[model samples]
Target: MSALQIFVLALVQGITEFLPISSSAHLVLVPVLFGWADQGPLMDVAVHTGTLLAVLVYFRKDTVGLLLAALGSIGIVPARRAVAGSVYGKLFWALVIATLPVVIAGFWLSASGLHAVLRSPQIIAGTSILFGVLLWLADRYGPRVKALDAMALKPALLIGLAQILALIPGTSRAGITMTAGLALGFGRQEAARFSMLLAIPTLIAAGTLAGAEIAASEDTMLWRDALTGAGLSFLAALGAIHGLMRWLSHAGMTPFVLYRIALGLVLIIFFWTGSS
Candidate 1:
């Protein structure tokens, strides 16, 4: 893509990736709606990579504390038997449980026939509306359950399974997972934070696998282009991550839900009119 297109896409990816709005949908629709060239896989990786770095940096203190608590004291008690209620221990197990379903399901989708069908706008509109409504209902009625660390194992897995819905083109991993948390009665901030933390391992696995594929490809020019795109995406993503976390913590997801509904309705209308 051209430099301007790349910059816009990077900015869009950065802001929307962490927000409750569907980053995948924005990424997909932006190019198609505006007739821009494909942002391609490399740029896609860069955007998420940037966001990932933002999350890591923003939560570094929590991460370090968790690691220390998990590893236990240097001169003190048993490391392996470190406090189970500790932030690190809890977050560690929670992340593991939350990541399991997506790992299997996402890899399966990538390898399966569903991969071929992933480009459909109809499916995007449908899933977007469906999950968007789900998020609304969740925020409306789900319980006031414990924050991420306090959640039960089974619930975390259930939310993770919900995350698998994002494997589809427009379903949006962050949107789906946050909805799941809301459905389980998590407060907006807590649900969003855990959703982000869980994304750490999940996205790394995805990026690594995709990067490996790129590396194995024979086209050297393609690799170079992909690297440039990925770099841009990463830089933009960092800003997105910072903004989303700050905004969501204070504002909840009502605005995003409204945007999803509007976007879905417009797409559905366009698809319907195409036949008439």
Candidate 2:
């Protein structure tokens, strides 16, 4: 890949990974749209690693709290006295409940080989528009009475189940999860916060699986490109997270919904014209 390809792909990954927009869709479409070679699983792992780092750094306080809470639950310390453990402990368990569904679903999809089969432009266009509408509806009508700290097992589990849809390219893990959050009465920013936090484990699992695939393949892992992608994506992801959090404070998901719709329409047109 050229420097420009690396930079563009990394930027797209970093920005869309967090936004309600689908990062996978953009990554797939960008290369096809530009007539560039597919950026193999190695690069996917690399950019995902960068976004994973961005989440850890941005949510360091929550990360530390969750860590202490987990340790406390494991008897490494008194649960009551551990930093933020009293509440974060419950949150820790809630996140666990939320992560299980997708992990299982993802494994099943990969094993069935449907994961690769679902990566077409038609699927992307349909999901991008469909889920974008879901987001808009959830935002427009859903009550915003809950905060992140108030999260419970049921809601978290529901959100996790919704995340299974993210296995489909344009369904968007962040978007679907946040849509579920909104529908469940979480405030917009609160929904986004939890969505991002939830991404930590999901991304780790994804990166690990992708890394393993690369390791098993005969294809050489280009460390230089990986590092460049990771570095650029890290910076872009951090900025995206910060900007998105700030934006959600004042606005709803309307802008993102519109963008997704527009993107989907454009993709539809492109594919239709190409086929004709």
Candidate 3:
């Protein structure tokens, strides 16, 4: 890919990855809309790696606490009652539970080849609109009183199930999970925060799979392009995460929901016009 294409695509991946907007839809549609060639899987892996690193770095303290708590839970370290009752231990298991459904569904869908078939603009447009409405409803009407400390087994599993919908290109892993979190009464920042933390494992798994494919392929991996994509995406994602968390404290999900709706409508119009 050209440097311009690399930069734009990486920026899109970074900004949308953690947003309520569907990154997959933008990744697919950006190339088509701009008449650029497909970015291919290696680039996808690289940009995803960047977002992974961004989230890890942004939440380094939480990551460390969770890791230590997990080790403590497994008896690898001394388990403190205080730590056990804190956000770290509860969130560690919550993420593990919330990550399970998507991992399993992703494997099944990939094996079935249904995953590829669902990548069309038509499906993306439909999902974007549908889930956008769901997000709005959850945000507007659902109780927004609970904090991350209230995260528990049932809600985490429900969010995981919602995450499975993200297997559809425009359903948006972050969007759907945040929707579930909102519906479960989590405060806006808390919901967004947990959604981002949950992305760590999901992104790592996806990057690893894509990396394996690159390793096995005969196609030349452009190290320069990959590194550029990674760095640019990391910077963009860090800003996106910070800005989003800050915004959520003052505003709600209305802005993001409207964006999703507008984007979905535009895609629908584009597809309909092209087909006609």
Best candidate according to lDDT: 2
Ranked by lDDT, the better of candidates 1 and 3 is 3
Q: Write the per-residue lDDT of candidate 2 for residues 189-220, one digit (tens) a residue.
A: 99999999999888887678766765666644
lDDT, residue 18, model 2: 97
Model 1 residue pairs with clashes: 14-240, 46-230, 46-233, 46-234, 47-233, 47-234, 50-234, 143-185
Which of candidates 1 and 2 reaches a greater lDDT? 2
Top-down lDDT ranking: 2, 3, 1
Off by over 4 Å in 2: 78-80, 209-221
lDDT (CA) per prediction = 0.74, 0.90, 0.88
Summarize candidate 1's per-residue lDDT along 229-270 as a digit string, tens digits. Answer: 556666666666677777866666677778888877888888
Alpha-carbon error at 214 in model 3, in Å? 5.1
Determine the C-alpha RMSD for candidate 1 after optimal superposition of all C-alphas. Answer: 3.4
Backbone clash count, each prediction separately: 8, 0, 0
**Residue 52's lDDT in candidate 2:** 93
State the TM-score for model 2: 0.94
RMSD in Å for all candidates? 3.4, 2.1, 1.9
Q: Write the per-residue lDDT of candidate 3 for residues 1-276, one digit (tens) a residue.
A: 888999998999999999998888888888888998878767887898899999999999888888787778777746544476578988888999999998899899989999778878999989999999999999999899998999998899999999999989898888999999999999999999899999999888878876676567665647678778989999999999999999998998888888988988998898977799
User: Over 4 Å off in model 3, which ranges?
Assistant: 78-82, 211-221
Which has the better TM-score: candidate 1, or candidate 3? 3
**Per-model TM-score versus the true fold:** 0.85, 0.94, 0.94
